[model samples]
Target: MANDKNNGQDNLRNAKASASNMYEEGKAGASKMYEEGKASASNMYDEGKDRVNQVYEQGKEKAEEIYKQTKEKASEIYEESMKKVSEAQENLKEYSDELVKTVKEKPLTSLLIAGGIGFIISALLKK
Candidate 1:
């Protein structure tokens, strides 16, 4: 009976030791998995940030290109408008010169035409 009790005590002690070892191994494995998961999450976050930054840079560059294009187009339009205005001014000056020359060359005919136009305008105003 004494030997049987000693055997039972030894078995119990061995079982307890085995259970403790299994618990320690499980804890170590869980800690390792947690660390790996944290590292993976950090890597994913960094990659996401890098992608966002790259997209932001591309957008900024595109906006700058658009702005430059718009500025060039506006400049071209302004130049075209100025050129048209200058042409119109030149045309007006030429017309004025022609009229002055005609008036000087044919003063009597111009006076007769002006008088006829005045008579027509006064008649319309009366109606």
Candidate 2:
């Protein structure tokens, strides 16, 4: 009976040592997993930040290009409008000169034509 009792005590001690070893191994595995997860999260965050920066640069470049194109087009349109205004002014001056010459050559006829135009405009305004 003493021998059996000793054997039971030895079995209990072996079981306790095995349980302790398994507990230590579980802690080590959990620590390794935690480190791995942290590293993965850090790497993902860096990659995402880089992508955002890259997209921002691309958008900025595109907007600048669009602004340049719009400015160039506006400049061209302004120049064209100025040229047309200058031509219209020159033509109006020439017409006025011709009209003045005609009036000088035929003063009575010009006066009669002006009276007729004024009468027609006044009649229209009354209506």
Candidate 3:
């Protein structure tokens, strides 16, 4: 009977020790998982932030490039318009000079033509 009691006590002590070891191992594993999850979350956040920054930089560069191209095209158009205006002014001057020379050479003919044009304009105005 004494041996049996001692053996039973030893079995109970072994079971208790096994339960304690299992509990400790479970706690340690849970702690390790929590730390690993936190590290993974932090790494993901950093990667996302870096990706956003890279996209922003690329967008900014594209916008600047477009702006420069637009500015250059506008400058070229302005120059072309100025050249056309200068050419028109020169043509107008030449036409005026030619008309003046014709008037000086034939004053009576010019006067008659001018009188006819004035009559036509006045007639249109009355209508």
Evaluate all candidate structures by whole-model CA lDDT and list the values in order.
0.99, 0.99, 1.00
- The CA lDDT at 90 in model 2 is 100
Q: What tens-digit string does per-residue lDDT give for candidate 3 at 1-127?
A: 9999999999999999999999999999999999999999999999999999999999999999999999999999999999999999999999999999999999999999999999999999999
TM-score for candidate 2, please give it: 0.86
Q: Per-residue lDDT for 2 in model 3?
A: 98
Over 4 Å off in model 3, which ranges?
A: 1-26
**lDDT tens per residue, model 1, 1-127:** 9999999999999999999999999999999999999999999999999999999999999999999999999999999999999999999999999999999999999999999999999999999
Pick the winner on TM-score between candidates 1 and 2: 2
Colliding residue pairs in candidate 1:
none
Task: Give the poorly placed runs of model 1, Cα more than 4 Å off.
Answer: 100-127
- Single out the weakest 10-residue window by summed lDDT for candidate 1: 94-103
Candidate 2 per-residue lDDT over residues 1-127, each given as its tens digit: 9999999999999999999999999999999999999999999999999999999999999999999999999999999999999999999999999999999999999999999999999999999
TM-score of 3: 0.72
Quote each prediction's TM-score.
0.76, 0.86, 0.72
